[model samples]
Target: RKPKTLLAGVSGRARPGRVLAIMGPSGSGKTTLLNSLAAQMDKAPGLVLQGEVYVNGEICNQSMASMRKGYVRQEDTFYSQMTVRETLRFVARLKLSPEVPYEDKMAVVESLIKKFSLAKCADTIIG
Candidate 1:
């Protein structure tokens, strides 16, 4: 569905194992829509979302239920000279389940990149 604030009333389901891109000009509420979905900011002034945000058919609000579904913001942050692996390792260390094996985690990470078609630049340095 389109965002409740700017892209309101637009509706569609994002399928698993695929990509969804929202294209628009500046001020088209693209970022605003993301902010709403992420719950990163309060609704503008008096705005409100009238329905539940579901993950796998379960509602998610206030505290995001699916922590494994990571959010990568538009503003990229990189530590100087850190390779992509190092940066991702650092992030996975801080964010991923430490109980999970490293190979498993790496596999999951790699799978995500492959599904997103990000392999061409997978090893490139972020900064």
Candidate 2:
């Protein structure tokens, strides 16, 4: 079987204190590139994934990328009936490692709430 290349020759810069958005039509490998950069891409048979990710000017491997970076999907897949905190907790439970204790996950959720300045709306329902 022939191997398919999902992304190649893709390069860009992301400066701190700024927002970087990857925009493209559907099936253009935006998610693929993001997963590769965030080290979240799952391995598949015959998949030859090769790339170097750098954060804060230092080269990072998969584990390093996991620790230093986070990815928020472009779509709004959360339930509108859930409050802000509920939504965050739900996602945290899904994304954080299973070995992470419940208390720890909640702590991380709280940290994210504060970091993103969502405390005021923590209990506000998404309408």
The best candidate by lDDT is 2
Error of 1 at 122 (Å): 11
> Which pairs clash in model 1?
2-10
Model 2 per-residue lDDT tens digits across residues 1-127: 7778898888788887788989999999988888777665673344557766667667785567657555796677889999999999999999999999999999999999999999999999987
Candidate lDDT scores, in order, read 0.68, 0.83
Instruction: Give me candidate 1's TM-score against the actual structure.
Output: 0.46
Could you report the Cα RMSD, in angstroms, for every candidate shown?
A: 7.9, 4.5
| Cand. 2 Cα-lDDT | 0.83
TM-score, one value per model: 0.46, 0.63
RMSD of 1: 7.9
Which candidate's TM-score is highest? 2
